[model samples]
Target: MISPEDYNRVKDKVITIDVRTKNEFEMLPHFDWAINIEFSEFISNYEHYLRLYNPDNKLIVTVCNAGNRSGQTSQFLKEKGIDALTLQGGIYNYKRKFK
Candidate 1:
């Protein structure tokens, strides 16, 4: 998992995928640049994700309201040979630390 400080240091060099549901995402404060991909959609369309994000090309960071979902998603991506990391403590920690 990546700490908010570490993420902030490399924010410009990484792609952040927020896996929160649409309703949750719309109602919460999130990074303006994060890509909103609902967790279910990401799981269902993993091939599409693989096509878009290449481990060798860019770092992938998964996020959610808390770390749980993102952690699971990161594991799934890694099992599929994609290098992915979760935001430690997710957006809540990020907001607590940086916002």
Candidate 2:
């Protein structure tokens, strides 16, 4: 899990994928560069995004409203051979750290 502080330091060095629902995504403050793909959709559509990202070349950072969903998604990505990471505490932690 990557801490918010560490993420900030490497923010430009990683690709952030937000696995929050559309509703939650709309209501929350997140990174402008984050790609919003709901967790449910991620299971089926992730490969497409993976192709677009070429995960092997970039560090993928998964995040959610909290950490649980992103943690699961990160595990799945890892199993698929992508070098991925889950943000510790997710958006909640980011907010706490920044605001």
Candidate 3:
């Protein structure tokens, strides 16, 4: 998992994927630059995401309201040879620290 501070330090060099549902993602406050890929869809169509956000040249950071789902997503990506990390404590921790 990546801490909020660490993520902020490399925010420009990474791709952040917000794995929340559409409703939650749209209604909640998330990093403006993050790409939303509802967890279920992301898991089902990971190949699409892998092609769009190839981790070969860029780091991928997964985030959810809390850390659970994002952590799972990160693990799944890693199993598929993608370098991915979960936002420590997810967006909640990020907001507590930086928002």
- Alpha-carbon local distance difference test for all models: 0.87, 0.88, 0.91
Q: Which stretches of candidate 1 lie over 4 Å from their true place?
A: 53-56
For model 3, the stretches where C-alpha displacement exceeds 4 angstroms are none
Residue by residue across 1-99, what tens digits does model 1's lDDT show? Answer: 999999999988988899999888899988888888898899899778757764455878999998898899999988987778999999999999887
Error of 3 at 76 (Å): 0.4
Candidate 3, residues 8-94: lDDT per residue as tens digits?
999889989999998988898798889999998999999887787764658899999989999999999999888899999989889
Evaluation by lDDT, superior candidate among 1 and 2:
2
Displacement of residue 32 (Cα, Å) in model 2 is 1.5
Model 3, CA-based lDDT: 0.91
Clash counts per candidate, in order, are: 0, 0, 0
Cα lDDT of model 2 by residue, 1-99, tens digit? 899999999989888999988888888877788988999899788888887765466898999988999999999989988888999998888989888
Query: Which model, 2 or 3, shows the larger TM-score?
Result: 3
- Better-scoring candidate (lDDT), 2 or 3: 3
Lowest lDDT sum, 10 consecutive residues, model 1, at: 49-58
Error of 3 at 5 (Å): 0.6
Clash pairs (backbone) in predicted model 1: none
